[model samples]
Target: MTSLILLSGWGCDARIWRPLAPHWPHGLEVKAPDWPGYAGRPSLADPTSLTDLADAMAEDLPADAVWVGWSLGGLLAGALLDHLPAPRALVLLGIGEHFVHPQGVSDTALADFQRALRRSPDIAREHFLRRQLAGEPDPTGSRRALRELLGTALPAPFATLDAGLEHLAHLDIHHCLSAASCPVQRIAGADDPLLAPEVIARADQRIENAGHCPMLSQPQRLATRLASVATAPDAKRPESTS
Candidate 1:
C-alpha cells in the first residue's frame, strides 16, 4: 500500500494535519511526522539544522512514500529528497524556495519574536495564530486547535528561532530542483501574505483560497488535491530543466 507522510512546520504539531488526514484516499496509510523539538519531545541543547532534521526523518520514513510538507517542513522535504530511500513525490503547502524577511526587518525582528516567546508565550501564541491562521474565514476553532498543539511542545529556544530565521533568509531550493526525480506539487493560499505569489509560480503551484494553514482553512479542498495526486498514474513529476 502507498504511504503518505505529512511534515508540519515550525512551532506546529501533527495536529495541524489532523483535519486533512482522514480525508485522504483509502488504501493510503498516513503518518504525520512531528518535528523533533516541536511535539513535546525533549529539548535539544543545540538545534538541528534543516538538513540534519531532514536526514533524521529520512531514516524513519518509508522507502517509497509521498511527502506532504508545510512551511519549514516543505523546505526540509526539498532538502532531503535526494537522500530519501524511495521518495516518489512531494506536496508542499504554504512554503516557498525561501522565507520572506523584508529588507528593513532587522535580525532583531526575530530576536523580538523569540523574546516574546520567552516572556509571554500566550501573547506570542496569539500573534502567531493571528498571522498564520487569521486569514481563515472561521479562525476560532483553528486557533483553539493550534493553541492546544503548541501547549504540548516546549518553547523553541531563541537560538533555534534565530537559526530558522537565518536559514529561511538563505534557503533556495531552485538548485535542487533538477535533483528531484519525483513529482513535486506546491500548494499555497491565494491570499498568503507571507509568501509572495511569484515564489509559488516558480514551482508547480496550486492556489487555494485558504490562508497559510490550508489544512485548517480548507482541509477538504486540500485533501481532494492530495487524493488526486496520490492516485494519478503520471503523478506529475517535475520536468527536467537541464
Candidate 2:
C-alpha cells in the first residue's frame, strides 16, 4: 500500500480533507498534517521562505510517501522537492505552473486580496471560499458540502494566511516540477476558475463538474484519480504543456 501525504491550500486546514476521507481508496496510508501556524501549529519565523517552510516540515514528512498538494499547498510541495529527499511521487491538484498568471489570478488581484486579508480576515476567508466554487456545475451544493466537511475548524493565523498569499504572488515552480527526480503528476478540476484552461487540459486527470475544490465537490472522482496515479508505472512522466 502506498503512503499518501495530503496538503491543503490557503484559508483551509487539514480538516478540509475530511470529505475525501470516506471516499479514499482502500489499502492506502493517508496523513494530513496542518501547515505551520495552522491547527495550533506554531508559525514559522519567515513563512514566506520556501526553505524555511520545507526545513520546518522535513523531520515529520516521510521521504517515501506520495505527496498530493492542492493550490498554495502544491507550490509548497513543489518547493520541497528542491530541499528534501524526493518523494515516491508528487501530485499537484488544481495548481498551475505559477499561481499568479496572466491566465489566472493577476498581480493586482492578489495584492487586493492581501489588503482584504488585513481589513477583515473573516470576510476575506469567506470570499475566498466562495471564489473556489465559482466554476463548479453546482456551486451552491459544493459550498454546502465544503462547509459540512470543514465543520468549525478555526482558520490559520493571519500571518500564515498572509504569507501564503505572498507565496501565491511570487512562487513559480514549473521548473521545479520539470526537474524533479521523482515522477510528477497533475490533477485539475475541469471547471477550475483558479487554473488556466491549458493547465487543466494538460493534467493527468480532470474531475468533471468540479471547480477548484474538487475534493469537496467530487471526492470520489478525485480519489479515483489519485488511485490511478498510485498504480501507474513509476516511469510515467508528466506531459509537457505550453
Which candidate leads in TM-score? 2
Top-lDDT structure, candidate number: 2
The digit string of per-residue lDDT tens for model 2 on 1-242 reads 66788999998888888877887777877888889998889999988877888878986567778888999999999888888998888898999667987677779988999999899888888888899889988889888877876654557788899999988999988778778888888889999998878778877778888889888778888887776666662534655554
Q: What lDDT score is found at residue 96 in candidate 2?
A: 69
Worst 10 residues of 1 by lDDT: 98-107
Query: Per-residue lDDT for 1-242 in model 1, tens only?
Result: 55778887766667778888667777777888676665555444556465566555655566577788788778767777655654767877777655654532235665676677678665675676667776666678767766665564434555564455455555666555556777778777766656665755654556566778778778888888776666662455555543
| lDDT of candidates 1 onward, in order | 0.67, 0.83
